[model samples]
Target: MATFSTRYSRLRDNVEEEPNSSAFDEIIMKQEQIIRDQDEDLELVGRSVNTLKHMSTKIGDELNEQAVMLDDLGNEMDTVDSKLNNVMKKIAKLTHMDDGKCTCSQT
Candidate 1:
């Protein structure tokens, strides 16, 4: 029977001299490169997400500012409309006033 150390050594030498060993090494290297590329892609995606979040916040702020401005403009228009209505009423009253008696003569 082969000794344990002899069997282990035979197995190790066989693995080292195997025809496909280089092919396995090449596959491992390719896998490692793929993982590194994926990591870089994930980092870029994270940065893009953060940038989008900041832009969304700015847009929301601008929308709120515009809403406040529109409300102020609406209030100013209401005030102007009320003043105009009052003036129209005063004009109508003046137009309804009686005119002094007038006589016309023809020769």
Candidate 2:
């Protein structure tokens, strides 16, 4: 009876002192879940960054087109100014001629 009691006590101690592997597995699963959430957030941020870059490029293109149109308008305005100056000069000459200061010798 004493031998049996000692043997049972030793076996109980060995089984009771075993490491809890389920605790480690639970910790590992929690860490994996956190990593998956972080990955999803990173993907969403990457997509938002790409969208902003595309919009910026589109705005730049539109500004460039507007700049070209402004240049064309400036050139047309210069041509109109030259034509107006020529017309003014002709009108001044005609007005002076009508003022009886005509330089024609066959009057």
Residue pairs in candidate 1 whose N, alpha carbon or C atoms collide under 3 angstroms:
none
Model 2 lDDT per residue over 15-83, tens place: 667768997899999999999999999999999999999999999999999999999999999999999
Tell me the number of clashing residue pairs for each predicted model. Answer: 0, 0
What RMSD value applies to candidate 1?
10.2
| Predicted model with the maximum lDDT | 2
Task: Give the root-mean-square deviation of each candidate in angstroms.
Answer: 10.2, 12.8
Q: After superposition, how far is residue 34 of candidate 1 from its true place, in Å?
A: 1.1
The local lDDT score (0 to 100) that residue 81 gets in candidate 1 is 97
